[model samples]
Target: MELDVHKPTILVTGGAGYIGSNAAFLLSQQGYQVVIIDNFKHGQQFYPDWARVIKCDFSDQSILDQIFTHYNVEAVMHFAGLIEVGASVRDPKIFYEENVVKVLKLLNKMQEHGIDKFVFSSSAAVYGTPTKVPIVEEHPCNPINPYGNTKYAVECMLSDFSRAYGLNFVALRYFNAAGADVENGLGERHKPETHVIPLLLEAAQSGETFSIFGNDYQTPDGTCIRDYLHVKDLASAHYKALKFLDGNKSAVFNLGTGIGASVSELVNMVTKQTGLSINVEVKKRRSGDPDRLVADPSRASTLLGWKPEYSSLETIIADAWLFYQKPDAVLYYSDQSYQQSSVF
Candidate 1:
């Protein structure tokens, strides 16, 4: 399906970043007019033609006014924020300001504009080190790191807004988001990348020494275990959340495959899928590193009728390996008419 000129617009904040870009592309394919707001802080330059791109901070009041005024935005899918866990631990001020304070500004603008529907990009990190195997939505949130705390703070704000102002929203708390939308030319492009799969793929491709972080954890292989969900699957859930707000009150869901893969296992799988060897180096475990983190993901399935189609370990690695093989074709157009003016 293509974008219908008569269709209501969906404003996607941070829509040029990893998960947001994939979701934006999927929304475009589903015939929604996507208006993307991104600052391009990560140096991600791949902008698709399907969406109108606005190069600015999402919290910019002048730009927000223009966007809300120009487009008949039905809802907002916010994915723009600082996401590095280690960095968040290093300087918490930036994390809180970028992730929490800035988002408050955006929400204030949304409330002013009467655009009450929101689909937030939340994180499973909010559950911290889970007490059980698969974490459920009701899991107690005890975030050990600043990153997780920021996400939880946002969720709390959304909850408050929902109750006080009738702001319908869905906060999809995600496990690990991996893989690429190879068909749509979308892939992970984080600068100084920290994600496991991408780092492993780069190690395999370049024969670089990939540190295992720690091998003394309580898990089977002693490395940390995480639930890796495909980016495409995450994108679909965002769309589902958007549709869900059409009738339901505010809700939250965990998005994952309910499967766990250890770090060593992921390394081995990278070798298996890429047919290349990674120079392995074991190191001290980073502080706040958990033994395991997996999601029950039953609420999303039961509530939104959403399921993960490409979250299997095999499919995740396969798609990621394919994405690592080539350079991303820049889809940004130089024509001014194709870009949304950020100027007030």
Candidate 2:
């Protein structure tokens, strides 16, 4: 797609991370110029050629000022934050600094630049333990861990910012962000690799025993259940959110498939997809893990005209497997910096 020079450019914070990178590519494909900023702490350095990559932390007001001055950014998709629940539990201070404090800096910059539209890359963790199976937006947010607390704090900030400064924002609370942009060669590449799908795939490939967390939950399989949404679908939702913001609307919606799959069920799907016997080892449940965390995405569908197309468990696993099988697949933390490359 040709660049629409007249359209306002979109700024993607943490555009090198899994979901941010995919969202940046999709936004560029739709002819919207994108400027990606990342501190390279947990984000991938590489991005699409059309995107203007600025290697800087969100907490740095000077660098953010430079980018805002250079580019005509009308909105921002905030995806730059720490996401490990275990790590957050261990070090709540770091999580609060990175997730909450840094975000305040970025929002201050956005306000200074008169950029009111914001799309937040929130997580389902904010909901903590869902009292109901199909969790809705109205559900009480009593996050059980520091990570969830940080996310909820940011959501509260967004609400206050909108009210005080007239900022139009949308917070999409994602369930399980799995899968990859197989066609574009982009997928999850966390250094520790805590997500279930990628961990199972790695175990199948390396013959390692994959831990099953715990089996004492009240679910059907006695394990946790999560709603998995594809990365591309997430990107699509972000795009639609930008369009939805044009009406001067500010809202919060859940990004999910409205379907639930257990941890064991996901392992079985991976086994079926790869034809490799996955070695499973049952372990005690980690702290702050909810028994079930599914989403009621009906409000998103009805309001933003958004629905996930790639919601199938089989499709999500197969796409991730394709990226994992690639011999030259890029690994996270391979180097300190990455060169600008175009996959399209």
Model 1 misplaced stretches (Cα beyond 4 Å): 1-6, 332-344
For model 1 the local lDDT of residue 108 reads 95
Tens digits of lDDT, candidate 1, 51-88:
87778888989888877876788999999999999899
Query: Per-residue lDDT for 34 in model 1?
Result: 92
Q: Rate the local accuracy (lDDT) of all candidates.
A: 0.88, 0.87
Worst 10 residues of 1 by lDDT: 335-344
Alpha-carbon TM-score of each model against the true structure = 0.95, 0.93
